[model samples]
Target: MKRTFRLSFYVICLLIGAFVVSWLIFMPNGQERGAWRAETGGVVLELTPLKATMFSETAHSCHTVIAFPAHMKLVEMLEGATVGMNGAQLELAIDGTLNTQRFDRLDALPENCTAPDPASASARDVFDAAWTAMDEHYAFFDLHGVDWAARRALAPAPDARMDDAQLEDMLLAMTAGLDDGHVHFGSDTRGYRSPAERPGWIPEGSNLNRDMLRQIAIANAGATITKSQTAPIFYGLREDGIGYIMLREMDVDVPIGGRSMDAMATAFANVLADLDAAKALIIDIRYNPGGSDTVSFGLAGHFIEAPLPVFTKTTRIGTTQTAPFTAILEPQGDAPDPRPVILMTSKLTGSAAEILTLAMREIPQVTTLGEPTSGGLSDVMGFTLPNGWGLGLSNQTYLTMNGDLFEKIGVPPDVPVPFETAPFLDGKDPVLNAAIAEASKYLQ
Candidate 1:
């Protein structure tokens, strides 16, 4: 009887041991824990086998990996990245994923997340990784009007038995048909711009700066200006009761842990207060490279008096798009009396700025002048290739209030003008003068 009882006890212990071993080796998820924190925002991340969740006091968001991989591969790729998460998190929030925080930096890594160097990753693995990521989550396969499957078939060296340059060229070829500037991939040392530029764009911004734009406004419009300390915003009053605001980018420069929208709001209020006496406003986003959508909407709100249907957003994930979410821009913060407001744009104005332009278009008093916007309206969804190459792709679509698709086709101006440096070279500003002229009619 004693021998039989001992045998039963040993058998039960063996079964328990086997179960734990399988869970650890085959599943490998039980070890994952909270490993990283954003440099700002008090946001923390919890990474599991195939999912990432970010949370803060007031917000929580979850993002799932579309194509599952062995646990360590994802960790290695992430560890290789020096920047991102802000882009990753924003990609979700941009397309209406709830409560995803924009984090510029992560403070740590998953403990014991050791893997072979990414250099040893085969080209086939990298290629397959990129292809699957896009196929599952890329939002513009229909908009770009190309068969993504074909891109995969056409990928050179289908075996991925090539060198880095060859792999990059193959990857670039895959995206050559996409009209999205936000779509690009690269390793830590090298990069490639989109082979296709927007219809009216310089892949690089127009190289205009706020200081130069401010100086020109002073020269041509007899303007008095002050640059914002908290952000890349500059504003003052121009002659003939016109207000001028030069937005270098839809971004602010607050320190780590500072709230960007709050900082922008304070700066915007100060600008509005100074230009309170003006009858109209000239807002130049001609030199702006887009940043936070929150800041963009926050600033745009100051120019309106009523809530309006602005834009609709949709995101692609795991082979399907989420249900469309439409948004309204409620009148927020300080506002001037309803009067003409000109949004000056160049091909340089994009992303969040383009979304801002779309919002402003709904208002009766707003007019967009100068060149068309960059037309890249989607947020840059972030990913990591098997080789640890960082990848960003347009994963969201922003439709107009009437459901117009405006991805590659930029936001058309109410008053379009040819983009040329000649006006600036000759000590004149035609776009500014034209905007002022347009605003004068409203004032009269």
Candidate 2:
């Protein structure tokens, strides 16, 4: 029976290797031999002897990079194309399959093709450039219910008579119409930031200080606090044996007292030692806005025993092409104890903070409490308009492991706790109280 089992295992390994090799050999590497469709439509953004880049706003809000074949006819067709012209497209037969792409609008031709002087360009020039740029680069118009074409049509024509201030107002209004929190337009003298209603435990501008929170936790929960010098991690053990940790932010740089060391990692290791000894832990992330996701994954390592798949993301490659990928949070070191943990969240918990919340939820022992997270998970990309104004927009979409898109929609908690400023101001944290109560049951 031992020999039979070994033989079966060897056979399975061989089959797996064969499957991998076949996949590598047969997979489309984006370069397939096919006949070129000469007459296609798009706005030529860049053209060179070896490659061509074009933008198609009507079909997909992205630029397509195409490698030129050695065919003279294809090269001539590309050379004949003019940048900022709407009439261009590509039809290619790859691996015996035909695919066609079309781009309808051109915002601005390449700088080499037609550079507009920012100081003298008409308001119409700036408006058209901004509109075209959004049409090509802004990825979430459909998701956010933005009618780009209608917005463009409604825009007042850029008059040469308009001053810089007037042009700025028009452009800012155009961006504000999108209603995306990530979308913003800024120049030297003025700026416009889109507003979002975030659900946080602490009210905005309430000034419920972090130091006060530490005092409240220590006094109310009978906890001993250990503050880290390298990172904003305040942790301690409660008298009831439940561990408490509050992470303020992820991106903190501190001196290591003349030693070449990773401060965040060292701080996390020390906190994990204290947490491992406790029967349970309460992680507070209410005030955290966001930072690097790597820090969140490092914290997740203390509870998860193996690599955990947290979320999936897709980036727009072309007008109709999106490349999807999964992000996995790998365990960093050995977790000595996988005890129950209660995570506290708020509306201020966003970006990497929200990602950490999701990662913690993958652990069976973790129970999340408080209001839902601030839904701003998508990745932001920046574009510069003709007038040197910068625009930031969400270009990538993130989804949960179960394939749920939570962009602009927060991740709800397992236990809902409404935020009340009065109770917190009085030094009575109802959320933390409930968490302690819940943890006591797990400890017992």
- Can you give the lDDT of residue 274 in candidate 1? 81
Clashing pairs in 1: none
The per-residue C-alpha lDDT of model 1 at residue 350 equals: 77
Candidate models: Cα lDDT each: 0.66, 0.62
Candidate that would win on lDDT:
1
Residue 368 error, candidate 1, Å:
1.5
C-alpha lDDT of candidate 2 relative to the true structure: 0.62
lDDT of 2 at 306: 75
List, residue by residue over 1-444, the lDDT tens digit for candidate 1: 999999999999999998666545533243333245433222345555444544321111122223233343332333211112333342122211212433433446434223324766677666666776677667777777888887767644534578778888878777777877788889668877664333333324663454565467557765766788777877777658889888877776644434555556677877787888888888988767688776776677776777777888876645566667776775667563465788898776777788789888888888889887777988776665656676787877788878888787788899998766657656678878888888787677
Off by over 4 Å in 2: 1-126, 160-172, 177-179, 187-190, 197-222, 254-265, 425-427
Error of 2 at 181 (Å): 3.5
